[model samples]
Target: MLIFSVLAAAIAPGVALLAYFYWKDRYDTEPLSMVVKMFLTGVLIVLPIMIVQRGLMIWLGESPFAFSFIVSAGVEEFFKWFVLYHIIYNHTEFDEPYDGIVYATAVSLGFATLENVMYAFGEPATFGTLLVRALLPVSGHALFGVFMGYFMGRAKFQEGRKMRFFLWISFLFPFFWHGLYDFIMQSVPRSWIWLIVPFMFLLWYRGIRYVNRANSVSPFRLLKREEEVKS
Candidate 1:
């Protein structure tokens, strides 16, 4: 029973984050099959990179700060973004700006799910620890994706000199955010722990606004455009 509870807490955040994206993307969402495939791609890509990073760090006698922030966060986020760009950048599914968020969120959640599983396995104090991890760290992954997707979509769809700038920002923003989040949580003293919660909440709040703005288009007009294209 105790173990089962642990697993539930571990799995719930990833599942809930994925569900939230699915719900938000109801109208212009990709098929479940594609979403799953993209997500799996993220997991497969990040896991290996993380493993090798840890190995190299151990060999070099490197500090966790260097490994976690510079190598792990930078490399992992880049690969995840690369996978999303490769798979869906030119696909028909990426019609709107918000589609970037949907796909990126899928990949991030995939990575988060596996990461959570590993953390949960090692964690001894089940309930309280699990709850805090789920709300903050796990959900932080989703918000990171939201930041990535927002800019990538803009870069792909928006047409202007500013679009390139936006694209650059989109790519770098998540990487910075992910790195900082990890760095702060890992390196900061326990006395400053209260700051982490609010910081993550700000990221979440920003993600929500991005999603709302992305989805602010008229469903009727989008349907009409589809019908016209079909005809």
Candidate 2:
């Protein structure tokens, strides 16, 4: 019973967050098949990320700066971006700007779900730890997903050198945000934990704004005119 409870605690928030992002797809929805496929891919990618992080730590030794930036932010974001760009970006279902947010959130939450489970059950587990992970770290991944998807959305419809630039930005921007989140928490004294609040607020604000902008420019919005002409 306790084991099951711990697993549920790890999983619930990730599901909730995944649902919230999927809800934002008001214009048109990607096929559930692709979404699930992307999600599973996200979960599977966690293994490689762990391996790489461990190897780095072994090579460089376990230190605050490395975990905060390189292993935590750099490795995770790089793989997420790589898989997202390689797999989902070119799919026909990625037909609009908003799809970027939707699919990206799916992938991000998938990763978050497994990550939460590990942290939750890998240790003794406590209400405070679960709550903090739910509200902060899990949600942070979704927010980073918003930023990534926003840029990838822009990149998807881009051409020439513009696409290249936007794609790089899509990856790096989230890497920076993730790094900043970890850096603040790890580097600062525990007494200064309160400092994370303003940063979280800013992240939430930017994520919401990005979602709106992505939705507003959805290529699906233009489908009406294309359909009208076809008729």
The lDDT of each candidate is: 0.79, 0.88
Give all candidate RMSDs, comma-separated. 3.6, 2.6
Candidate 2 vs. true structure, TM-score: 0.93
**Total backbone clashes of model 2?**
0
What digit string (tens of lDDT, one per residue) describes model 1 on residues 162-208?
A: 78787778778998888888778777767547888788878988999
> Cα deviation in Å at residue 118, candidate 1?
0.9
Clashes of each: 0, 0
TM agreement with the true structure for every prediction: 0.85, 0.93
Task: Give the alpha carbon lDDT tens digit for every residue of 131-214 in model 2.
Answer: 989888999998888889999999999998999999999999999999989888888867545888889899999999998998
The stretch of ten residues in a row with the least summed lDDT in candidate 1 is 213-222
lDDT of 1 at 184: 80
Error of 1 at 162 (Å): 4.3
The 10 consecutive residues of candidate 2 with the worst lDDT sum are 186-195
